[model samples]
Target: MRSNFRVALIAGSIVLSQVFAVTASAAPSAHPERSSLVEDIRFKVEKFQLDNGLTVILHEDHSAPIYSYHQWFRVGPRHEDPRRTGLAHFFEHLMFKGTDKYPGKKWERIIQANGGSNNAFTSRDYTGYYEDMPSGTLELIIDIESDRMRNLNMKQDEIDSEREVVKEERRFRVENSIIGAMYEALFSTVFKVHNYRWPVIGSMTHLNATKREEFKAFYDQFYAPNNSVVVVVGAFDSGDAKKWIKKYYGDYKKSEIPAETSKKEPVQRGQRSVTLRRAVQSPTVMVGFQAPKAGHDDAYAFDLLSNILSNGNSSRLYNRLVYREQRATSISSWAYTAQEAGIFNITSELKPGQDVDRSLMSIYGEVYKLRNGLVSEAELEKAKNQVMTDTVNQLRTVSGKARALAAAEIIYGDYSAVFTDLDKYNKVTREQIQNVAKSYLKPEQRSVIRMLPKE
Candidate 1:
């Protein structure tokens, strides 16, 4: 089963630049220049919307006989009420339980019979479902997806069974796992008011208390044509795909979009700390600071700063703490951006008997240097290049392109933001990185969590 915990964790901090281009044959362009490649991608992408507020994006690539279909809903853990946390994530699993027309097991059986695979995941900001199948099965996929949008049939028994599954998932992912427990503690400490303080998997207490009627209410409110975007990529005719979408999804009525939460997290006045004693062999340290939201101006600089600090073997954290100082077995940093403000976290696993305080101080020393404008032009360029290369590599697959487009539309409001944001990274200067470091990474604004082995 796909879980939102990992997706939200990774997407929250990572700024994946959606960049690249492949020819109609899905082969790399022969020119090998960035400008030419970007233009090629711009030419291939097509987007349109239906009358009922359903947005559709299509990218035609006849290189392979396969394609990926994705439906992204703009609701996730962030949209859930604090009293009923994890409802959005619960629906991620519940969506597959089937509708009246299809019935249980029928959805998965039909897809597998057609040589296709389908799965979905939830995150803080969105929940998405996708299927990878041969080009011939596009209509079938559309038919099944559209039917379930307004017709999901959830009985009490199925709801109770899936509630147990989600509870077990929370046990395995958050309660039992040390790192998972640590992350939960860190977020709870970091944001006192924001719904993001809770894990997307939710708490067992809330999961158990949630009723069938509550689930239906959530489904009716957020799962509407207006709140969704359908993205189709790979080998398909755009005109035919549009016609199929109209036939399947055109008549679904749009529901009232929920008003966003107005609660704001108050600024942290002093450092907050937590310690967890779990069954583990090694100790770990995670230091997190509140940062700007996704698509915020400061977010781009923080993304580049995260890369410079710990992206590779040559990064400051890796070379100083993990290699040269030998205080840590591993060290890394991430800037998780969301619809609301996010966290910029640095995590380290220390070698046996290493001093956690000393290691944390060393990490702080590096961040302080960045705040002092110590980053060099070459270092900035190298980090940008690393991000660019990683972005291009991820976009190489059809599934990856589909995901990028969906994320762009969901998180940034325009599918073109995926391409335009590449320039934001390219334009980030050393001064901007230092300024963000100073503004956001202050010690008093940080939340520190240490997980130690229970003796």
Candidate 2:
């Protein structure tokens, strides 16, 4: 799923595009007692496991009469074989086609009758489905979700139709958008061994080649109760929620989930680059560096450094490249974290007739200065404040809190990390930031993608 959360900056007259999913928004002010807030949030959360190995997490919020119910499965594009790249994502669409009990359009009609909305998204690491409904409708959503989890009746015709729908989605999102194409190219060139090298939306050839049996095998393998997490947030009683979860999900049997033995991506020994000629208005350059995994200590420092470089107009890259030099129209930097190792990326859209080489040098110069410990104490403080404030803002929403809890559990193996991670960010020192920059942001460890306007 593409994350709705992002931290952004505007450079000169141009606005930088958001570089990462799972980012935070601007906050009113930094909360000094963030630990208390974390504790408060933790207190409201209730977690338990069902006999069938189904994991359930619940959060009660009486402020509103609405709630969000989400189910996150540990299957995504990363679980697919190289030849069958898009099956995981394609199944996301097929899931909505309905089971025998619910049938076509029946599930959606029931949700609409109750004035609720439902949707799902697939990412490289997980697939998530959620429903936001008025509090009274929680049981209804749970029943529908639980029914489909084990009883989905897939038809050959539905698969055929949805396959085309996925193809059209790819056409709109990746094939037609310059930035989208650049993102695909960036990962493809960055990793040689990992499945992350492929986009979440599988290629047209693979989608067309997939068979119905393959689809059934995938569903049976990864969609088991043991391989998923169920989260419910908003106005609800924890006890009632658990009872409902057990009633609907307890009887489902856990299947034998297979172990993932994908080859580990080897270390990069030199800079890699790819050039794409797209029909666009301006030339865009994207640079990526191999970075630490999500739970790693240095990831926090990298996150802070990304904010310092491009979180706002006052950021280093915005002021340097957009205002001071006026060579680039916009620039953004982000450290993307996943279940495995992540990518730290910087992207710039250059002005007409600007020197790409010169812009690259200017950006690298600023980065090298960070390695040299030129970051002042004030700048470091500002970055920290932004990170903390963003965290507070994210926790303010029910869906946001639920997503954080689910992602933390699925990706990091600890839901408490959702709260403790802020402290990790707070503990990051200027020295650590400089050290990470020196260690990972080296010339040989980077990849460059230049998208030139097609002649």
Clashing pairs in 2: 1-122, 1-123
TM-score, prediction 1:
0.92
How many clashes (backbone atoms < 3 Å, residues ≥3 apart in a chain or on different chains) does model 1 have?
Answer: 4
Per-residue error for 26 in candidate 2, Å, reads 8.4
lDDT of 2 by residue, 267-336 (tens): 8999999999977777899888887767788878888888888878888888999999998988988777
TM-score of 2: 0.92
* lDDT values, one for every candidate: 0.81, 0.78
lDDT of candidate 1? 0.81
